[model samples]
Target: MPERLTILVVDDDQDFLGDFEVIGRDFFELHTADSGEKALEMLKEEEPDAVVLDLRLGSGIDGLETLKRIRETWPDLPVIMVTEHADVDTAVKAMKQGAFHYMSKHPNIKTLHAIIQKELGSVRWKNLCLEEIRKQYGEMIGRSAPMKEIYRLIARVATVPLNVLVLGESGTGKELVAREIHARSGRAGHPFVAINCAAIPPALFESEVFGHERGAFTHAVSRKTGKIEMADKGTLFLDEINSLDPDLQAKLLRVLDDKAITRVGGNEVKRVDVRVICASNQDLEKSVAEGSFREDLFHRVNGIQIVVPPLRERAEDIPELTRYFSRRIQMKTGRAGPVFSGEAIEALQTYHWPGNVRELMNVVERASVMAAGREVTVQDLKLASRSGKSQGFFQELLFLPYKEARQKLFSRFKSVYLSELIQRNQGNISKAARQAGISRPGLYRMMENTDE
Candidate 1:
């Protein structure tokens, strides 16, 4: 069997610690520490993903003292504190210290399981990505310019363990970038936890991030572990990080600085070791300046910034991207794919795609689905209207002499008038006349003269 994550359970009660061991033995290699001194000794060799510590550990150097030392030596360790009934004040104080979470006596086993899994899962993900890359790619993909730049940056700073900020538009594959960095870094095979800040609601953000003890508050049906604890000794990818609230931002900064986190509703300082990689569509700098985000947090996260260029900025990659999409679409749809006509390619090249590669992929996928013949036509391209005019808006003018620009404009208006009339009447002319703000005879005369 694979080597499981090491977990330390520290409590004065040997019976309670033994129970925890039985519950977690299947998933982790359990270690028990009865006192603060013992816990510190265990920590030196086994940097655990989680530490279950009791608030009252006999008499000398209590759980709180052990937590402080843990935070001092390994600030990024995830710790969970156990408390007695009505120990809310102490719990709150433990939270202020850096406990990832806290739970009361007779805590829910299911909640404990969930918290352990969340943290353990993050570790598994980081390991899988790095191990897969080393075993398959030998090195990360480097043919693409954006990829090469990222590789260079990772190689330079992977050993230092500073925060990395990855900026890109949605669908630009920022998560992949984060993975590549972790794979190349010294912490490869450790946890790689990813969470999208914008995807989670603000109301549940705290519980989603720092976790909550069972019955921490209303609807706190079970205990939950946030991504931070899951990513101990690994990398944490904070996608759409700009959406984090200002208050949460401050809390996150505190964690980054002290390497600790306090779970919601429970108090105990948990130490965690994590490298944060934050990605955002928004300009965090501007947000910081406007007081919508924390500047200190921004600096901490933005230690090394990598901006992923939009697909349009790298126009040279269109053919490659298009071809790749085409092949994938063909495989998925099992369609006899239409070849892009020369004119169709030219039209695509001229287009100023506002939606970037994601849009391009959609266009190709749709075209593949709608192909009726062996070739995709200019008409099939369905380019956005030029200046909001309907189909043939530019084509009609393109054929006209250069000097007839004004005359072409007039022709366009006449076409618009007829189209509008048809639409207003539901394809009936008599009703369209009144709706056109014109007389029936006048409308007929206009239609006759403008007939294509």
Candidate 2:
């Protein structure tokens, strides 16, 4: 895509790292992360094209765990795992986990160069294709058949002032559709007020929907206009219509039927000329069947119904959705956000996304924060889930690059560990040495080497 692809080589083996960097410098913009944590931080700072990840990262998140997070965040980015864990089991695990290629430690420079180029060569064109797709979908970002049908319905209903009911799961962007319809309607010049029916308490719901008098209640100190009054000449979006209380539901039905609303604790009725748009994640028909929701109110509001497809049902839209969210993140947060790697988008499509578009956006936002100096890796995505917790020791490390992977297991061999342990003891080399089961002079020697 660019003149030279960026390659991040992460290995704690100093000699091997030096050799690899020397070999890679000519062919790529080289970056290095000795630990998985630094590698991840680098990824957020700037997204590299590919990573030469050693299977053994001594501390923070292990190599495999880091790879997993990278896939979660940047599924499309290629990761080439290099390790002395040359066993077939390890190779198979790495391959199944989506590593682009796997090689034993100390790979031939020529071979490594070829693999890196091959993995990254097509990325530029792929990115161009994605950009084209993003431009094609102006606002509604989906190409699935269900969405196509929904578009037709939107066009048909936009001009009419019919009461519209939007049905879908939570986070399916029902509110977006309502806004689109209002924007296209004749009342576009007027206000488009929205209220979440389920969010308001039952006691306050009526007063919220209908204007309230100054002395209507203890808290009612002055005349207050409600959502219905606010949308007098425009559209009133009542979200979560099923959450409206039975009594409030009846009052709302009267307003729709009579085109007027009487303020709370007032005798005079004020007329209104407004269109109503209702949205609900709960199935109003089922609620009506159970007698928990009023049938008359449902009939009054259900002049026309629009069903928004869940994200999983329309997976084709995710590419554009991710791009949309990325652009929005830049505008909203005022920062350059991470681009979705091809691997990352595929992983997102693979997910069931029970929380729908909302969850996907949340994952993207979090990934942007963790993109590092390189692109988001799979590891970032896995960590984005609020419930994500490390499943440590899931697999045996017998195939690990024992010398490097086990470095953290042996504290005396680790300079970073020595420095941190010394600091933890408030720079008291004696206590640190005692706790580390090492002589004071041994700690001093380690510190001297660390300084060197």
Candidate 3:
């Protein structure tokens, strides 16, 4: 497929927009805005490869003001200015304000295309250099292949502090990933505020995030700082971000774009400087497609995507993780550290950790209390080794290593389960994922690997 590079044309001329749409249809995807204010809004959504702007706008904000905001927010963006014969001087002013090039109202379409191509070429090289600088492993623990890949991605995206959308299963330490990024960043000294979006009540969500003035409400007797305000000069980690109230989703996006927030029941807009990193167990793209999540807000937060693989894929790290968590827990509790037997470690590795690292930590802590003589044996490590109800599989599981038997029996079970599920939902992966309480991508992976 030809690359669908987007080009945004900002002008009040309906005829001109229609002309470009027809002209650029073959080579690119075209988006249009009638006013400067709308253009900026569209820019956030469309994220065009390049912009064709009119020097003189109709109303709200003129081209100059729009250009200024774009330059401030997305400085490297290339914007070509178009003007009428009477507005040539204004076009020159637009150039001085960081316009890529200025042209007549009826500029040659070929020249405009060439300018867009040139800008795209420059943007690619700029992003390439940025990617090279962003590749470094932080304090994340894990030497597994999958984990090394995650570290690579973390380093790749850490250079410029772009808004990130972290995706992982529950108990996969999403917050730790956020903290690692912040710790390696320039804002390490600043507060790293985090809130589970699902934990906040819907009625108090707004006040909790944006604060409330003293006596602003019936219960508000004291002034309090909001998460956005507290996270200024730092990072805000929103866990289970898909659970944010629909009403607050739009409000959050506006704050992110404006870099300012007005407290609930207050009129003053306080400027904030915070990098937002959000995590979701749910598939946000599916949520957006289902209309439960705002598509615009999704795009705003997904500047960089990092998907943390589930522990089952990185079982090689279990023993190391076990030892690390053990030492840390021992230091905190001053208890005798339990020695994990080779059998115990193999038991942990063999089990499919549905709850991932967090679950493993809980098991290790429990084993510390349950162990006899500071030695964690196979009996002490009561790991869950069952996948699904396959006749004779549980008895057979006891005899064979989990990984060896997983292919033949579990594949059958998963294939039957997913086949029934997909059929029940009429082949809708999103609905099947929700019904099975797993991520859509995970469900798809199972279906791809299964043979039933």
Candidate 4:
């Protein structure tokens, strides 16, 4: 049996609330709140699939404020606003504040039930697709929308024998996506050869890609097989494809078209069945326009283009990625891994990861190894922002609720100010209190409260 969906109804009308209980009993598991304060409390406890809120409450904060607060914490949850006396201005305001839908109280309960069902239907389908991707792609550690779309694209393009071009910054896992496509395709059992175009010298580029006969050049002591030949009946991934020399690009285009390669200094042609997948951190289109990369080769290798999102764009996945790296470290070292504090994770999410996922993995591994105890704090991560300031102080507050964040900011300010004042007074509380324009006892109390 399918699990029943849950909804929270917030209103002050006792009689209408009772009627809704009977009306929605068959379709949903219901929770009721009489005021906005109670509704926010219930939101944290119940975590319902959707919320039905009244525009006006008899006491405390009204529906609009409640909706704004709900959006702050749970931005993706569906919220439908229903009022007994809905005005055009009020409905527009609620919609602007992120209400899923605004509806006036109607005589029939079926209309309200239908709206909820329609909203949740899409949410359920997305979640189901995400679950399937999770089961299949275990190496990709993200559930964000961008990652989900990439998973769907990979699934669609895996079976088709077409060239793929992956575009992303360095360390964004472009090669990982190519490998995933190869793993899911018919070429899974064959070799998945990879070569870095930028790492090879221009002189050896031809010999490295296509086999050369014995004595083809000074270094060619014997007949050698190249990456393309080694990856026969499989996938060949060329990283930094934009760095390939223009002369070699034309030759590669010819091989891709003919599905064959001719050995250097030899007449025999070799027929090979290889699917080519290329990746470039640089802009290949701009490179082609600049007369560096061949436009013909560009189109040949770019049958399908997949762009891997950078790590900074998917900050929500940092905690999961952190846990994954920690687990791997534990397995490798045969010891308990360091557990990251909540603040540490928040600091990580706020960082501008210019190096992308590979950089994140390195940071996690380093922090785990250097941690003095099992618990790793923000200081252990040692993150610095682009401005060269520590990320633990101000940037982390972006992830917290407004009230809590304000309080933390004030507390941090107090700690810094009071410590400086006391140090300037040479540890004399009386002199520090005089300078701060407060009584000595009051200064002592402030120090006690802000300690650590």
Q: Give per-model TM-scores.
A: 0.53, 0.58, 0.56, 0.58
**Tens-place lDDT digits, model 4, residues 1-452:** 23456889899999988888887677778889999888876665557988989988889999999898777555567899988897899999999998989987543556666777788887788778766765678578798889988989999999998999999998788888999999999999999998877656677778878989999988889998988999999999998889788888888899999999888867889999999999999999999899999989999999999999999999998887887898798899998766676578888899888768877887798899899975677888867622135565677888999999999878877865785576445477875776577888999999999943
Clashes of 3: 3
For all predictions, the C-alpha RMSD in Å is 29.7, 17.4, 26.6, 16.3
lDDT, candidate 1, 206-258, per-residue tens? 88778999999999999899879989999999988888888878888888999
Identify the runs in model 3 with alpha carbons over 4 angstroms from their true place.
1-139, 385-452
Number of clashing residue pairs in every model?
A: 19, 37, 3, 0
Q: RMSD of candidate 2 to the true fold?
A: 17.4
Point out the higher-scoring one by lDDT: 1 or 3: 3
lDDT of every model, 2 decimals: 0.74, 0.78, 0.78, 0.83
Question: For model 1, what is the alpha-carbon lDDT of residue 198?
Answer: 60
Question: What would the per-residue lDDT of candidate 3 be over residues 1-452, giving only the tens digit for each residue?
Answer: 44556778899989988887886677668888899878866664546788888877888888888887777545578888877754656767787888888878787766677777788788789867545533443335677888878777766676676999999998787777888788778888999998767656677788889999998889898987898899999999988889887888988889999999898888999999999999999999999999999999999999999999888889888876887677778888886666676567878888777767877886788787778754678787655433343345577657887787776666666755675566445566776777577888998888787763
Select the stronger candidate by TM-score from 1 and 4. 4
| Candidate ranking (TM-score, best to worst) | 4, 2, 3, 1
Error of 2 at 7 (Å): 20
